[model samples]
Target: MSMEKISIIVSKGSLEGIYPALIMANGARAEGIEANLFFTFFGLDAVSTKRSGHVKIGAVGNPGLHLATFIGALPGVSGLMTRYMARKMDRLDIPPIPEFIEMISDTGAGLYACKAACDLFGLTKDDLVPQVKDIITVGEFYEIAEGGQIVYT
Candidate 1:
């Protein structure tokens, strides 16, 4: 059977963490497949108006960076990596997080925030970006994501 839908769960707050889901969802939309992005836990930072623009890369403890934990943990290292990656993405014409989310939303893809996560973080509906359709529970997400492939990142 052909894949008709996708449900991507973003759980991390970093740049690396959020971009994969954005790319996947945008790709799915481009392919005419139904797509939904569910932002939960720390991932909410990617959709938060206050934090989306400021989300940083997680260099510490990230094996992909190939850096020692201590070095990655140093002040300014994460910020440096984040800026470096942002510049690279810019060179490739990739939009930043806010604009990316807007583009994804314009594609008719669904964007949602986890209600439990919002409650845990003391966030209200007004605190998130306008692209978020709603703040929903896991069960609600399941209901919306039913019959779709589930990808967690």
Candidate 2:
């Protein structure tokens, strides 16, 4: 069946965590579906003007640390892994996080921030990425997401 819209909930702040949502949202728009991104909890990082493009992968608690947990505990393994990921992304022509957000916005996707998360994180609208069209509660998001598929990542 064809969908008219899709709502993607992004709840993770880490680089690895955010990508899945971004990919899905972009994919939805690619197929002419309206897309909305709801940033809740730590997911605000991906839409924070100060944090968006600079999200880091957490090596410590990450289940897929890519190295033996013991080896991943080394002082600089996270940085190494981050660099390795950057290289891989670059080779694949993935834009930086900030640019990715811009592209999604330009493609007519709506970006929404979670009000509770903003309050919990002590952030104001100005602290959010420019692409954010509104700060909304989950209830409001639900209203907007009506008749759309909701994918939580």
Q: Model 2, stretches more than 4 Å misplaced? A: none
Tell me the lDDT of model 2 at 80.
81
lDDT of 2: 0.89
Candidate 2 lands at a TM-score of 0.94
The runs of at least 3 residues in candidate 1 whose Cα sits more than 4 Å from the true structure, single-residue gaps closed, are none
**Error of model 1, residue 10, in angstroms:** 0.7
The RMSD (Cα, Å) of candidate 2 is: 1.3
Q: Which candidate achieves the best TM-score against the true structure?
A: 1
Residue pairs in collision within model 1: none
Instruction: Give per-model CA RMSD.
Output: 0.6, 1.3
TM-score of each: 0.98, 0.94
| TM-score, predicted candidate 1 vs. hidden true structure | 0.98
Candidate 1 lDDT tens digits, 3-75: 9999999999999999999999999999999999999999999999999999999999999889999999999
RMSD (Cα, Å) of model 1: 0.6
Clashes of 1: 0
lDDT, each prediction: 0.96, 0.89
